[model samples]
Target: AKTSGGFAPFSHTVTSVTHHKGSSTVRALSMISSQSTSAEISWGIPTGSEGRKLRYIISYKCVNQLACSPGCQDAVEGRLTQENTRMTLSPLLPFTQYLVTVTPEDGLPSEIYVGTSEAVPTEIPSLSFRSPDRTNTSLTVYWEPTIVCSS
Candidate 1:
């Protein structure tokens, strides 16, 4: 009924509204962080709506209890179009756990759906140096893999 942001302000009345069934699907989830901070988030739009207007919201929390609750200090809310929607959350602390929720707006009230994702670990690989002779002319280096295995 009420619209915000750069869009025009208006309200519409409907006879009846139906809440979407099942859970919201997260098409893509990622973390955007700097040298010492991280932000965990996901992006996707409600499916099976068949062109119905929708609204999406995402919430998150850090793994380290001392760090902060609601890892993402800011809240992102926006209108959904017919095409797939993508939502990028605010910056968060490094190596944290985040919970996100998405909801669609119908004529009545919006329904809530939730999901969770963890931030990728940030650990630098250790390097080793080797040389055939005392001279530094030709040296060989070995390092561990930068990626982590899930199993």
Candidate 2:
């Protein structure tokens, strides 16, 4: 406090504080299982990075014509401990391409990892054809469905 010769002149000085955001760091994503109509995804957080009540959001889209359809979004909530972080997307189209990304709460919008899902086909039948006469101009075709066919 400061006082003048007459009475007193008082003044106060106040200090203000502000906070800024920190740098962005995200965990890596892993593909657990990929099926004809479904994909299982997983990821992990850094050591000592877990905070209170953390949540995850998984975003995905058809990246290739094989499974290309439209973009889809899903989310997982809870804290992760000894168990591996996992999630599965099912009922997808056969032989399609998909892109998936995982994002955590309090994480930067751009600090996320993107991964691709495997292309699996439901068709498992194989066809075989042979002609009776190799030298004959006329030919007949026959097909037998085999159980071991992959695309």
Candidate 3:
């Protein structure tokens, strides 16, 4: 049916419809250890998935059931644009074992990386020093928060 600024009616029968969206084959996985209660993860874009729009889904949980107590289910899930392949999960239980997985939109279920969060002090302690040991001391330190941080 065709319409030219007027009402038109059309009807048809369909057998089936299929979409052939491809999947990303993860080439590599890199993880940044969690300092206190988080971890950073990034992976190489799949060779075939490049230049194509996609989405990323990350699922994680505490590996040891005992750590989670009665439920032992500390699962966490998130979704992000394909461009934002890397992400950080924070506020996780400190000193806990976890299993993490990254899957593309419609990708298969799989677990590729496993890591533990760093142990943290009950409180953020201030940097303290005592009596410079009666000797002159000097130190230079550099701190970078994330990959996107400038300077």
Candidate 4:
């Protein structure tokens, strides 16, 4: 029998239903360019996920963790919400390797390895003059290497 509201009896009708959404994931990550202290990257989202603002959880860590001071080597993370595929990470150490991961909301994360370029030397060189070899017209001088010797 139908009730006044045209509904079945409470005991005979469905009370509630839960619908599960499909799972999507970040598909790809690529490096666009790099500088001495920054990196620009791009990523791909799952098909059919375009045009909608998506929140990305971005995290990065230096591959050479030993280079940083203790308690300062933790991974850096940030959140961004946009429909575009490009973003920039800055204030990174020069000539270092980093592992970057981007996880879109409700999706699996994509990871990539990136490297920053070497920066110009910032240390001042130490110069010493040899008095024994110095003359009015000629002089001998020695200078200590300023930048770290990578060779």
lDDT of each: 0.42, 0.49, 0.58, 0.70
**Candidate with maximal TM-score:** 4
Q: For residues 1-151, what per-residue lDDT tens digits would candidate 4 score against the true structure?
A: 5888797755766689774343376776899999877899997776667766677777787775333444225444445565567888887777667888887777777889998787765557787553347788987677765544211
In angstroms, the error of model 2 at 38 is 0.6
Stretches > 4 Å off in candidate 1: 1-36, 65-84, 106-151
Report the number of clashing residue pairs per model.
2, 4, 0, 0
TM-score of each: 0.34, 0.46, 0.55, 0.65
Error of 4 at 75 (Å): 8.0
Spell out the clash pairs found in candidate 3: none
Clashing pairs in 4: none
Colliding residue pairs in candidate 2: 37-92, 66-96, 67-96, 67-97
Model 3, 64-108: lDDT tens per residue?
Answer: 532335423544444444457777876566555567777777665
Tell me how candidate 2 scores on lDDT.
0.49
Per-residue lDDT of candidate 1, residues 31-68 (tens digit): 33322333333444445655565554444443332233
What are the RMSDs of all candidates, in order? 15.1, 9.6, 12.0, 5.5
Candidate 2 residues lying further than 4 Å off, grouped into runs, are 1-25, 46-48, 67-84, 109-151
TM-score of 4: 0.65
